[model samples]
Target: MEFRYDKEADANYVRLRHEQYAYREEINTERRIDYAADRKPIGVELLCASEGVDLRNLPEQDAISDLLSQHHIKVLAS
Candidate 1:
């Protein structure tokens, strides 16, 4: 998995797999889920990421937390 932040867009993306992109599911104004052709989740995108992200609904919370920490991103507690 990989954690990437786009400063210009204020977006944070968590890539769960390196695979072809199929489509995306918008969870809301601030969140989207990317899926592969098989409908398996391949990535997650958090918009307005500078505002912080909630990890409760995501997988690999611990690893994601570490990655976010490395990038100086905030993880909001639920």
Candidate 2:
């Protein structure tokens, strides 16, 4: 998994797989879910960065941290 942030777009993306995305859906405001061709979830996109995701209440923050703990992932924030 990977986390990418775009300062210009103020967007954040959590990539769960390196596979190409087949479809995307806006689950709600400023949030989109990406799926692979086989319907497997590939990742999630958070638009407007801070407005889209609250670090204090991130639903998957713990899960992501746990995954990152298994690997050497460099975190960046602005």
Candidate 3:
């Protein structure tokens, strides 16, 4: 998995794997899930990430928590 933050976009993208994009599921205004053709989640996009990310109710929370810690990004409780 790869965690990337775009300063210009103020978004954080967690790439779960390198796969073809089948479609995306919007979780809310701040979050979206990218899935492969198999319906397996391949990535997660977090908007307005500067405000901190809420790990609650998100997929792969454990891994994302670790990533956020490594990047020093604030993690908010939803």
Candidate 4:
């Protein structure tokens, strides 16, 4: 899996595989789930990053850490 933060867009995307999205489901105001043509979840997108997902913001303090531990996330350090 790959998570990328686009500084210019202030958004983050998590891609599990390079599959064409059949449709996107807005899980919430800021999160979207991307599904492949086969109806499999292939990716996720977060609209606003700097506010919603502070490295310190997850309800569980270690949530982000756990996630990063499982996959590769590219966040350019400022």
Residue pairs that clash (backbone atoms under 3 angstroms), model 1: none
Segments of candidate 1 deviating more than 4 angstroms: none
Q: TM-score for model 4?
A: 0.63
Greater-lDDT candidate between 1 and 4: 1
Model 4 misplaced stretches (Cα beyond 4 Å): 54-78
lDDT of 4 by residue, 1-78 (tens): 666778898787767678888998876676677889998777767666666543322222254445644544432221
Give the 10-residue window scoring lowest on summed lDDT in candidate 1: 55-64
lDDT of 2 by residue, 1-78 (tens): 787777798777788878988998776676688889988778877777644353332336566555544543332321
Tell me the tens digit of each residue's lDDT in model 1 across 1-78: 887888899999999889899999887788788999998888988888889987766656787788888988888952
The Cα local distance difference test for each model comes to: 0.84, 0.65, 0.89, 0.61
Residue 12 shift from truth in candidate 4, angstroms? 0.6
> What is the number of residue pairs that collide in model 1?
0
Q: TM-score of each candidate?
A: 0.83, 0.66, 0.92, 0.63
Off by over 4 Å in 2: 52-61, 65-78
Candidate 4 clashes between residue pairs 3 or more apart in a chain or in different chains: none
User: Candidate 1: global Cα-lDDT?
Assistant: 0.84
Supply candidate 2's per-residue lDDT for 71.
47
